[model samples]
Target chain A: MNHTIDDQVLAIGIPTDLLSTTVESLRAEILPLFDDTALKYSQVGKVHLNLCAVNMIDSAGVNFLVGIIRACQTRKLGITVTVKSRFVHRTLLFLRIDRHVELVVAS
Target chain B: MRVVETHTSPGNILGVDDDGVARLVLDQYLSRSGFRPELATSVMHAQQIIEMRPPGYFDCVITDYQMPEKSGLDLLIWLRSKDPCLASIVIAGAGEKDLVAAALRNGANNYLDKPYRREDLEQAVNKAVETTRHRRELARNEADAAAVGHLQRHLLGGRNLAIPGKVHFSHHPKRTAGGDFLNVHPCPDGALLVLAADVSGHDLKAAFVSAYFQGIVRGMLEKSTPIDEVLSFFNHCLWSDWGDRSAVTLEMPTSLSLCAAVLPPGRGQATLFSAGFPDAQVVLPSGEIRPCGVGGGHPMGWFAEALPERKTVDVPESGWLVLWTDGLEDHARQLAVSPWGLAYTLLRRDESTARRASIGDAIDDILVVAVALGSASFDEGFPILADQYAGDRWREIDAIQNEWRNTLTLAIPALSEERLCEILICLREGMLNALKHGCKGRPECTASLRFQYQSKARNLRAWIDDPGPGHGFDWASHAYVAQRDLLPSHRGLSMMHHFASRIENHRHGASLTLDFHLPEPP
Candidate 1:
């Protein structure tokens, strides 16, 4: 997964499995560089997750996404997720996660 | 210094004289007496002031006799013709006793002599002030009552229709506050409801309760309450609110006659419940009139526990339904109704204004509503309200479908309940396709539906209109899907076609029409 920042948007490309090891690297490595609470400047409260390469998320991955959404909601942060795969969109719709998360799909 | 508070504003006084000294002296004295006094040098100028002044502004007038052009008696005569109750004090020079007599004849309230004492002028001004204050108070009270009458007219002003339908009605009250009322609401079952009521007596109290009662009925109808329960609830609400039915000699105690009905549109049937009202009559297309129902029940609020019998009447194709209070019948005789009578009343109505109008200014409270059952032009049909909403408006779509079904059932009850449900499911399928395929799976894009039911023709038809490029669906290929074991995702357009007597697809899958045949009423 590639991490990039342009202007105020933090586009974080996600992994396919979204396993513990992948999430661990994000928290320890990628998150610290972006979550700059010590400095005066920081990424705006907006984060966009590109899930074009990711598919077939399990319950664990779903739970992880929900946690991030809840945290963003509390900090008055907005999160946008783009899913390219119809299967992933169907799964999210089945779980009724679309009620809480803003899920964008290619028409 | 004492801060004395006057109970009311100081009275306005118009002082008139050709003599400058007399005018100045009169003005000073009146001013010291706490009056806003204006001076006019001649009778004509004073007359102009009274005519041009805001109505009821001047409280009193003081005039010196023997003015240049006109006398005090002339001004007094003019003021008396306008308002005899206006207070006036006439001033006369020595030996002008003859002129003072003429002033008194012209209705002057008091008189003061030229070179009169300070006490004499003071007493005359005081007495005149007392009478003018009394008159102003009475006039103010009259104005306040007129304002309340205006408010009642405003509250009853919601008689306009959002869209014109086959039904037409007219309501005429003898006073600004009369007890007649009418209401029409669409039911969830595709039926149209009509409510007409009259408070037992005329005037403000009756009119007020009529408006209040109509409001409650509307709230219940919006929740899709049944016609029977709606009437029962109305009766209970009235009885509970006003149970004091003791005799008041010649006065009829506060009670009301109400008739409520659900007419399944295009179904040729009307289910009605009435309280202390006469049987409504139907006016055939050929102008023949017949009674729709036979019985009249207790007046609403006559008893706490009363269930008026529900009567269902089937109207002839294109016939008109007439619901009225006795006032209309009375006006049908010799009573002149207001201007609305010429256009809407049955005897005077034509195709132009299909409603009812009264004849002459009626003393008795009058209200009438005549609904057209058949329109002359059936090809275009009466247009039902067409609305577009987001794809997720399934609840609204279901509501619309249910209303249409109910209308069919009410109009022709012999159709099996199962059959109605089947038709509704088919209709819903077309709508879902428009919302899903035509709108690109977006909840915000609009999908449209139109329903047409012609009870006389015994048919229910609907069209689902969408704004997307055609799905390019082929009806021939999907014709066998209902018979074959199908996947959950595959639409059973075949079942929809089977339920409908005839189905048509058009505009490259952008619009579809389903026609269902209704059974005879049991």
Candidate 2:
């Protein structure tokens, strides 16, 4: 697992093999970042997150992502999640999460 | 050794070869097997044989691959295209892998190398015959499925026209058709039977029960069976066939809530029969509305012994009788008024020049007013505006006029003059009261009204409801004081009191139920 932060943006890179487990950990880890002073000053259009390296997401992982999106929305901050796998794109589309968040496909 | 004679079925095989010598060899093989086979010297000769005889002239076709003008694959394709079920075998002097594969793909049942064993020919014939039979069965099933598709479309399609003069009707199907059904049928006696019923459940099985109920009711009406007997027969049928077997618990109420009214053609009185449904209403000539009730009984199609109560109300000449499904009543109650009040307001507003203009331009004009008041987004003041204008001010007044004209034309046959006027007055007053007092400044406050008539008692009733609490002012005391003062503004309350036989508050101040009697018939 690799996590990097630049300005108010957070990027988490996980190997395809541990993608599901890494998403679960990152969802929990991302909450504390919102409380940080550097992130608090961010405007709606400034907050951006990348999960591009994740390949497989089950229902649980998808649910965690939805929770993060909702929390970000309540604070009036804009967040974008990058998904590289077609499976993830299809899963998000089916669940209608695509309607609420900007989905960036790396491929 | 003496050969056993075997009789071959007619047209069982066709043997084609180019050389006369090959034909001689086939003849010898046929005699040895104690059977007969047709022989053709060339492709043209085989064609000539087929043209002369009708189809099924031969059961199995055995042909050589190498022939002038046409190959074995060509003949196989032609025969199969003509009749897909036709079976054939191909034989060739030189065995080519590509040719064999192509021949089989083109529908050749079997292929043989030129130097073939005698037993191979017999085995090929047996397989071809079996393949032809299987293909025929598949064709039959396809035809059956097509027929079923046609029948389903005809039965479940929503093509029936809306019968004129009905109020507050909704068929929100849980499925294609549900346990609840309403049908208006014109009887041979020139009378109309309006039937509203609710079957047991909410699925396809429930739909079947509804269909069964419809058939029985229609039969009884056509036969002029007594209303009570119709209910009894339907109840007995459901109890015996469905009561215990239904997916719902045996104790679960498996009954239909029904209201049936028989209206004679022209301006004659109607006989009503009801079981477990909401009350019925008759709109009188003077615009007053009233409720008509039948003694209660279990809904039809419930228990075997459950008897339905029958009540007859003489629908006054030139008046209208309104019956409704539970959905309409629920929708009315949800709006905090009797469904009759909504009907009354609609009828009353329908007669106004401004509101009638709206009806001329669009049927949705009426629906829009009802929807706006019912909407939570509309503030209390909005309904007041609506009550004054009868609709949105943005809509063109001329267009509203056109819509009302059309609505009147459509509704004229079902409505009587006096009933129409009474409904309009009640609706105007009710709407004004809701707008001025109930919703005032709150945009979210709502109100609705329903008007109806009870012909037997010659009475009209209006039910008015608002989201706000009832008026703190005493209407009876107010009426008495207004009479004493002789104030022009106080005339509305006096008029309302004089026009109606009784006015009562219900559900606190949320609803006002008013009733008025109709004039006796000539």
Please report how far candidate 1 places residue B481 from its true position, in Å. 81
- Angstrom error of the Cα, residue B278, model 2: value is 21
**lDDT tens digits, residue span B446-509, model 2:** 5655444443455555567676675666666765553343222323344455445787776665
- Ten-residue segment with the worst summed lDDT in candidate 2 chain B? B365-374
Cα deviation of B460 in candidate 1 (Å)? 36
How is the predicted docking of candidate 2 categorized under the CAPRI scheme? incorrect
Tell me the whole-model lDDT of each prediction, alpha carbons only. 0.66, 0.55
Per-residue lDDT of candidate 1, residues B178-221 (tens digit):
78787777777778888888887777678678867777778877
Best by TM-score: 1
